[model samples]
Target: MTDALQAMKALIEEINHHNYLYYTLDQPGIADADYDKLYDKLVAMERETGIVLPDSPTGRVGDQLLKGFDEHKHRARLWSLDKAQNHEDLTAWHTRAAKLVNDYNTRNPENPLPPLSFVVELKFDGLTLNLTYEHGRLVQAATRGNGVVGEGILAQVKTIKSVPLTIPYTDGVIEVQGEGIMNLSVLEAYNQTAAEPLKNARNAAAGALRNLNPKVTAERKLNAYFYNIGYTDGLTFADHREMVEFLRENRFRISPFVRYFDSIEEVAQELDAVVSMRNTFDFLIDGLVVKVSDMRTREALGYTDKFPRWAVAFKFEAEEAITTLQSVSWEVGRTGKITPVAKVEPVDIAGVTVQNCTLNNIGDIERKNLKHALGSQVYIRRSNDVIPEILGKVTEEQDGEEIVFPEQCPSCGSPLELKGAHLFCLNRLECRPQLIGRITHFASRDAMDIETFSIMTAEQLYQELGVRDPADLYGLTFDDLIKLERFGEKKANNLLAAFEKSKQCDLASFLFALGIPNTGKTTTKVLADHYRSLDKLMEATAEELVLLQDIGDIVADSIVSFFRDPVMQRSIERLLQAGVNPVSEEAPVIMNAENPFFGKTIVLTGTLSSMSRDEAAKKLEALGAKITGSVSKKTDIVVAGESAGSKLTKAQQLGIRIIDDEQELLQLLNG
Candidate 1:
């Protein structure tokens, strides 16, 4: 009961947030089908307890005209099915069924349970309707409002051509439950000139169905699928399959993808197939519903106050949406790479409002065939934590203007070069974006460990002192900083102190901090492992660099090109003069055959209690251990501390030895 209350509160908040996204912001996160799943659950809860929250979306009617549509009492109550997000949840449900069946078998040994079979069908994402037929003609249609009394959208529902106005053999009172939907094409057409654009097809169908005018609904070209029998008399079906067969034989529109699975594994596998072909359908679908085949079993496994224990919906991740591609926001990276970020009109995909998603490069733009000229609508995907990716342009509805790529840098006005797949700016040292990126990289924990320095402070330094390079940061004075907006005497002291502290960083740290193109932390570690000293690496020829383990021709050229720059050379010299010393990793290591940590792949993750992660890695490297970035089968050990994530899980799965903290690591290092 407590769980139900919490679920009710959560559902209310979630539904209201989606409502704001759809109705107000014009950017809905989830599709109408997904929204229905959540709404159905809330309604089921309300029906069970008769407890309704004032702010719940279940209590609310259409966007407008609540009083316009006449209310009609439903013949029988409507209920919503609970959902399962993953295969594990589905398996758990099956496990519960096994327990129930086993208990039943114990009670009646002579009537042992038969092999469990189930039906899996595509779950439509649209508005639910309860249609009633008298004799051989459709009499009324209703929206599932509070499950008891519904808004009589009979005039509007009659506009749907897919619904059968007259079916043969329709005797006594018969109530059929189905979904009212609009196709992708029709929704697109309606949104093109609507006063306020429709977010998706489901929402469009819903609004049209509840419309006071029947003609408004007629123009939408709505469709529907009848799946469940709500209220029935003078009919006795053996099972769900028999009833669905009746609907299909009578020419009622039903989903095409329906199959019987003898096992949960087969059902789970079929779900994967459904997902793969989800986009093939003309209409949208959220998930597939799995139900017990035997009506007797369904009766035995009765209702759990809300949904039936006999069935559960297997939902997929959020569906995709198409929206206008307003324009692109081009920005420069630390490597002077010009990236194209799409500025899309707010659209919801999978419960996320996406406005900006990266297009990567010119090649990517051409390959995806994006018109990208400020008016074309694009196909975008929004998944959890994933940056929305523009699939491609869906329509060519755009203004007759083209977005020309600039040859000159937007920041420093230097000529841009087409470097392979990306655009690069020659003005590396002077460009504000690159300069800030470089300084931010330099002050990063894995680089120089300058904790007090930030991008804002870097900007302040640039504006005040014209400090344009990473080395220019070390030359800043306490007096120079004290004049800035937020820098007080204490902050000035802290900044200077942090700067002084970074000078004692390791050789690999300094190389990584230099912000040399393509020389990431891993590459620096490889260089540190091979060359043993920063000066030796700086003096090495490109030919010599290419001979090293992981160093490729491109990386070698980048290293040679960086050291050849007189400006970069001066910057390094000035940094050295300012007391920045790149130290070796303690002592040179020789292979000791019996050393406990010898020639083993180890990964370091999270914060170390004693020293920084870089320091610990270097120390372990000095003891003939190789510190790697990721955990794999080759990894002999994983040194994990607090807040360990996926790496820890991988290590545990592989049965690899784990060093809990620096203490255990040190113990193994000395042993």
Candidate 2:
């Protein structure tokens, strides 16, 4: 190799090692800033030299967009694993595997039992990708499109920070197979800002990897953990566990949850443990992949055309059931959009009796062709093991009649209009349901957090006290509340007190509480923080509003339209007249506080020793400190406690200050 080529190889090796440490091991030998500096230096060097190595990280970006996916035949056929749905199914699979191995050994006679052992690993909820490496450099990465042929995703895969551009093992050639998964935290954060949230992590990862922009794929933070060597030269292992350990040592991202078991019962127990701990993990896992540990036994058991006889995926049972749609009702949300809700005859799914499910919007009703007629048989499926959704009409016409969309708002009798598939109540102020929903939303924990006012109280105040909107909430009196059904003097006083306290909520929360269309808690906060006051945000033009990150035309228009409403404008004036100061024009500064994070953005990592994460966050917020979700350049302090993982390492690498306990934080706050 020439000097430039050798240097390029060294750079690739260094970057790949860092990638393995950060993404795979969840430990980093260097900080993110330092890593970025190194990466930038290498890129600049390649640019200046004008001699790019074939395996250089810069070579990953495709020069041109392809019209469609082109399939390349797989070197080795990728087969779908047979699945065991429940414990019984798992036991049956184990018994079958044992029997197959025992029968094979008996036939051989001289081979003996072959030492039966199994390797159990988490079945990641992601797209399977096959990566081929030549001379320790990743040459090709392809999606497992149809088991036989897959679209070449090498260019896209190279953008993934987790996938190493060069393999650690400097061998002849190796083909490693793994699943490309979008981290659950990343997906959740993405969805919070996404126009339409993805259904699950797997779909998000798959969609992100296929995007035209490599930068977009890079932003998704897609990760991969190699589970099997599809084909490798000059290496052999007696057991699957040993092979996984070998891969780990070689700086390959190996499956972390792999466990070895000696008996069928032991395997079942381990699988159960894995399932129980699923929620605690940061990535999505759909099932457990169990394979015979002994390579000799696996060979003896052999494989079928579609699956391995030695291995099976023990999948978690689908949380789904059939129920009768007893009634369908239209609920006017705070934003005046009508949502269809299905009241069903109770049916047990995943140990819970689900009697009600969200129909999302009118689009869902029409898509599912859900009839309002009572007694409609509907099949409900929990999408991704949570949030019940009506799949489709199970049995068409039951004893119930077909339901029709209401021509008028159910709460205010105002005529409704169909904006796209949604029924909108034009009476933004007078609509009783809308008013109640707005108040409830404003009082929600994510909003102003009026702890004492219940949704029922809001509704009652709207109906009984003739209150039309949130501002009218201030017009309420202790006497008026006491006269309501089930209201005592003490309850009435508490409700009034909460309403009074809510007036002091910051500008951002107040903006969020207004229930403007497309304005969520985060967006409202950004708008409020950016503008610093309600009047400034109200004066923002559509073009200006759209300039904010996560804000678009629809949201900007909604905001402008909200301020333009005569009733809403009058309500704002009334709130001002009633001494309801919504905005904190100036943030109070803690001067010379002992706390190290007086004016900095501090994030709590892992489980805190002194208090719950929420408690720590609350305490920090009380001390004029800004709390953020992730470790970025803006983060000034990271209070790491027990089990501090990625965030702690990232913070340390960034050279952000750290504190160990709440007392230290308190001192900072006081100082």
Candidate 3:
């Protein structure tokens, strides 16, 4: 070999070693910057010399031109997951699975339903691949092509860093099914510099895998999470969870979010929790995969040609829709920022009828040219499955009508000023729409937990009851509510009761209820816990607010803006005058040095056998435990009883540690 070729080989070896350490073993000998420098040097050398080794990392970008995929019949038919659209569908699927298991157990008492349990995993939004390993070495890999037959992609699959070239399972063949996913962060970073950005992570992965150069594929940093053992020899796992554990133990890249649940409710809770934290995860997950634990039970349940009866994917509602844009209307939010809303023909998206989609700001509208037509076909997608956004215009025809930016606010008719892309309404206190939205936000469950006051009710109360703001809500009487259209005595009474109940909320909740732009429940709680009173919090400056944990410039600015408002100040004063007491300062109990439950949040549900609820709470408090009435992300342990309700369900959903009895609690506390 030439000197340059020898040097290139050495550099490639070094790069591969570091890559294995960083990606596979989670241990890096050198810094990422240093590794990148080494990789760059190797690439430059290879380019200069025009000599490239076959097994070099640079050679793994694209797959070789295949004549065609070799037809290979699967040992067992790979069935798709039966999809559940919503919670009701999920419950129905669970019920059917349970009934099937019960029937199986009844018929064959001796060989019962092998301890029914479920392995819940995230259904990745990517291509699925089936990898077959013979005698611990990867032999073949194929796509899930029509379940029965698949194209061979073994040579290309070997390039994936996560796909192990060899496994620990000896003297047997095992087919592992998994998703080939592109990391969202990596895709975003690549898109930032690329001339054309990929639409999503799934599409990015698909494009990268089909690339002509294997080196390009390696550059994408694709990952795989093996979930199913399609065909295994000399390994008899009774349940899905066990099989997952086995795969994990054998150094296979398994889905980290996979969990075992005892009941269907647990599965539902898991699904909800996954949806809640979907944004936080690095990879894209479309839904939750729930499978019957027992292999025999699964076999008995059997499969249709398309989907398995025993397994179901609880899919979240679709966030994308194609619709005709009827017109565009600019609306001012609570912050006085003018958002151009596309008045589209009503389209069902994500389980809700979306008639209006936010154009974000003037810049967004102008860039997309959303306001050019009265009847334009448009594609819309929800960002993070929450906020509706217009992707782009589909049609090219515009009736030569120029789209103009609104000079005045839609609600208050106040003059608008352009602050960069956002048109700001100067009428803060007088804007009726802003006031209504603010009041509704304040009374929301995450803020003050005012159950009865919705947006419509707030609007009616504003116009009919002569209430301008949230403070005016306290002035409303049952008689006033009863007088409104469609409001009966019972509904009025309930609203009044809810309003009354909200008056005694904690200082944190009250702070959040102020509808400050960036202040959320957790931030409010932190501020309230630290300051302990609204008076102290109100006195705090922007700098002081920013000093708190997780408080950034945006949040600090919002807090300062809210407090600086004369109308908001008057509202707070009026609330105080109306006998709204927001003081709930519970001193944290200090525990002994030897206390077992130091730094743990525990929730008690149902009735305790050994101790009263209060007694149990007191004991936990004595051990330096912080007690919360509800189970949330904050709750660490849940002491469940015979019939624990939603709290228990939420606890399980959040993956909070649960203790069934007093003994388990004691063990956890001590440990």
The 0-to-1 C-alpha lDDT of every candidate, in the order given, reads: 0.74, 0.69, 0.69
lDDT of 3 by residue, 56-89 (tens): 4453321112223465556545666656767887
- Report the C-alpha lDDT of model 1 over 1-671, residue by residue, as the tens digit: 43454445445554654565554333455444446555656777877855553245554342221445677778667765776777887998899887887787788677566667999988887788999887668889998865666778899999999898888855555788999999887887877888887666766787888788899899888999988887653454657889899888776898777798789899999998988898888777878899988766675676664477889988777446788778876777666767666788987564346776556566667677764456777777653222456777775544424556778888888999876556778787678888887787788655797966666777888788888877888888888889889889998998898898888988888888886654556677778877888788889999998897756676677788988889889989989998999986655656697887788888876567777776777777877888865665668988887656567777899999998866777776666
lDDT of 2 by residue, 580-624 (tens): 787754554444465555677887776666567767776677676
Candidates 1 and 2 compared: the better one by TM-score is 1
How much is the lDDT of residue 661 in candidate 2? 73
User: How many clashes does each candidate structure show, in the order listed?
Assistant: 2, 12, 9
Q: What lDDT does candidate 2 reach at residue 178?
A: 91
- Model 3 residue 590 distance off true place after TM-score fit, in angstroms: 3.4
Q: Which portions of model 1 show Cα errors greater than 4 Å?
A: 1-318, 396-400, 592-671
Q: Is candidate 2 or candidate 3 better by lDDT?
A: 3
Residue 308 accuracy (lDDT) in model 3 = 78
Highest lDDT, which number? 1
TM-score of each: 0.47, 0.46, 0.47
Model 2, 316: alpha-carbon shift in Å? Answer: 3.7
